[model samples]
Target: KTIFPPEGRHWSILEEKFLALVAEGKVFFGKNGESQPGLIRYLSEVEGLVPWTWWPHEEVGHTDESKKEIQQLFGKSAAFDTPKPERLIKRVLEIATNPGDLVLDSFAGSGTTGAVAHKMGRRWIMVELGDHARTLVAPRLQGVIDNEDRGGVTEATAWKGGGGYRYFRLAPSLLEYDKWGREVVSKAYNSAMLAEALCKLEGFTYAPSETEYWNHGHSTEHDYLYVTTQTLTHEQLRDLSEQVGEGRTLLVMCAAYRGDARSLPNLTVKKIPDHVRDRCEWGRDDYSLEISALPMAAEPKPDDVDLFGAPAK
Candidate 1:
């Protein structure tokens, strides 16, 4: 509200407004950097919930409860020795994150973190290297998704689980080094796998056609990819070119091909391993950042000095 004369000025609030404020409990600091007569407003504030340092098992959960949780999901045979309580995980998640935030538990023992995160409406990634990942962790997460298991913070968070998660298994590296240190596709990869891998590398979706042998994948309607371990002859290329027809192109990856491959208009022929060798890391396994692997920095010259006049070391 605007006041005509807000002259009873204090440092910021006008004195007249301040006195009027004191008289009617209405005068307060106004926009003119002073309290003015009949000019008043108030601001309200809300205190947020304070985070506590201590979490008691009585409130979150204890080991016995966690064991029972595992037992309920998969029976005693699959229970982890060091499984964490779901409520414990829930408490931590509630404090640290909000709905739809991602939670990563790299050491996912019994998948308590994932289950709690999911129930709390958060996305999660759980990694377990042990075999229990399949036997214990996966089954536990499945229970969380199905809504059948409501033991932990499920009821507290009001989560009726329905979302699903993806699972992946790590396979051995696809490339290996031959006797002469030449990079080649691993023998472990069959023709189908090789084709799929090459398709992915070439940015094509791998969808093998049932009717057409040459159709391993396609980048577009007119562009197709064919992968093979067989050595193609000139006649085979001629046949493939004919089948591919006009307004269509084919990328042919073969072990080796006889005769001039460029003569075919529709086919772009490439040699396996030779065309692909540089694209992948071959044969080596250890990728750890070892101290010895790093190039040592030369010791600073004893005569060198920094800008601050400190001796270099």
Candidate 2:
């Protein structure tokens, strides 16, 4: 993923997009100016695997050597101007995906995704629209499969064996206007798709609820969490609070509130705008900003310097 500056220095546009993506459970950002623009790639299909904050390259083991190797390999090529580092992709693959799992990279670029996938014993499918797809993406991936050491992965130990991949180009969007020019919705993903996407975005494991009134989902720790887009009355809060597990924190996100959130014990009622705004801020400004200029002292000579000054006196 790459971070580009706001389109026209329009912070509002960027904020709106950021908030919308966050609400949809996409990506997160740190405090203003402390974050870079990038996409969070999902390497596995696990709930709560998506991070709630941006992780720096240093934090993810992206070393200077690895970065230099990647730049040398694909930086000269005009075909892939924004190629991601293989080490970065490898880390994501290690965390989210397993061996033999299918990995897809629609914007294949320099084929880092495919190369990493091949080395990690996973199958990959890549899509590239440009003419250099063959010259650039293909050769990079071939180097990985054939274990060519163009970038630094030696043939002897890097990819001692071979792997396979299939390339394809998909339409812009599944939805297209008919001859009559009317709107059309594709059946690519129905309710199940929406639920799965929601689950992925919201860091929840999707499950059907026994009761009709409550939606069912759990975190990675198997803690029961209920989310509703409706207001909770006092009776509803009391009843729901009773259903909360012992020694567990009951977090509830609601649209409107009628009763006081402090009334419910062991329950953390999070109001949308207030909670999000409170948690997310531009900067903390905790550090000191004062600066001073002082003259540097010259080193003293052993003979010229006084030896405890009092002995001479």
Candidate 3:
């Protein structure tokens, strides 16, 4: 019979470890807690008894619909918001990957993946395009690494913090522009700003680009997003596809493309303006009704006040 624990208090490592030992004939207990010598008929294999890195039910905070969509689209079991419980990520690393395995989260919103991987004895690389990458993600990770929060793994279990992670900011894409808003052939962009802008334009969590090569940016599921204001030639298309990583699809958004869609390998070239129309308001002024220079209550009159005391001046 399978037994389940209470909501937050799931089975601990010590319980599982002891159970495995008992099943393996390594230790013996006589009647009424009396110690007895054990004879080993077969060595108990504890391979399956490894502690499962699973977040308890209470740790999962996503709603049924949102959770379903995220799982269907990204294959990531967790949601994409803050306060992403550490227990959930811990479970993911435990079940899907082995120790020292490289876990990657391009949309590392709050660095939950990094935190859990670190706790579970795994290596991790995460990318966050939001400003919180520095303000929130870094601090949260620092808290995890330094054991600042007493309620994390240290309080829950035996946690000896030692390792650390290096932080990096993605560089900008558009560095140099001609007077007519065209990219100069030789000019380079500031890496940080370019990375940020590209992520904004293409809806990516992180942008990976070097000088003279603004190749790709990636979100969680989608990768190799290319955005160009100009038309793409066959050679440029081929070069772009080559620069993109292997086994991943390339999503190219440009004004026009002169390549055969069937010929390109794992290439999805979208011709903007024709295939997709701009839905955003252009050159429209939006004024807030609440932002008014006029006084809310034009100078309070003496008659406006109801004086309880008898006063007539």
Candidates in order, TM-scores: namely: 0.66, 0.34, 0.37
lDDT for each residue of candidate 1 in 16-97, tens digit (9 for 90 to 100): 7455547875543546746433433333322235578888889888999999988888888876898888888888887889
The digit string of per-residue lDDT tens for model 2 on 1-313 reads 4554444432223457666656775553555734653334354632445353676766443555555655565664343445565666776777779898999887877677877788878888888787767777787777677766355433322567476566554423323355786433234635444344335445778774777334456674535455554677978887877766566555665545788768776576765434434544434677654556656687643223211112221
**Candidate 3: residue 138 Cα off by (Å):** 0.5
Taking the tens digit of each residue's C-alpha lDDT, what string does model 3 give over 1-313?
Answer: 3434344433333556546756875444545545432322333532334464554566643345334433332345434444445556665566689988999998887566777787777898988888868865687667667866444344443566668889876543333456986433224534354344555656676555575354557765546666665788999888777766577777776668786866778678876444332423334587446655775766433222211112323
Top-scoring candidate (lDDT): 1
In order of TM-score, best first, we have: 1, 3, 2
Q: Candidate 2 — number of clashing residue pairs?
A: 2
Per-residue lDDT, model 2, residue 91, is 66
The 0-to-1 C-alpha lDDT of every candidate, in the order given, reads 0.81, 0.58, 0.58
Evaluate model 3: give its TM-score. Answer: 0.37
Model 2: residues with Cα > 4 Å off, grouped in runs: 1-54, 59-71, 74-79, 150-158, 167-313
User: How many pairs of residues collide in model 1?
Assistant: 13
lDDT minimum window of 10 residues, candidate 3 = 303-312
Better of 1 and 2 by TM-score: 1
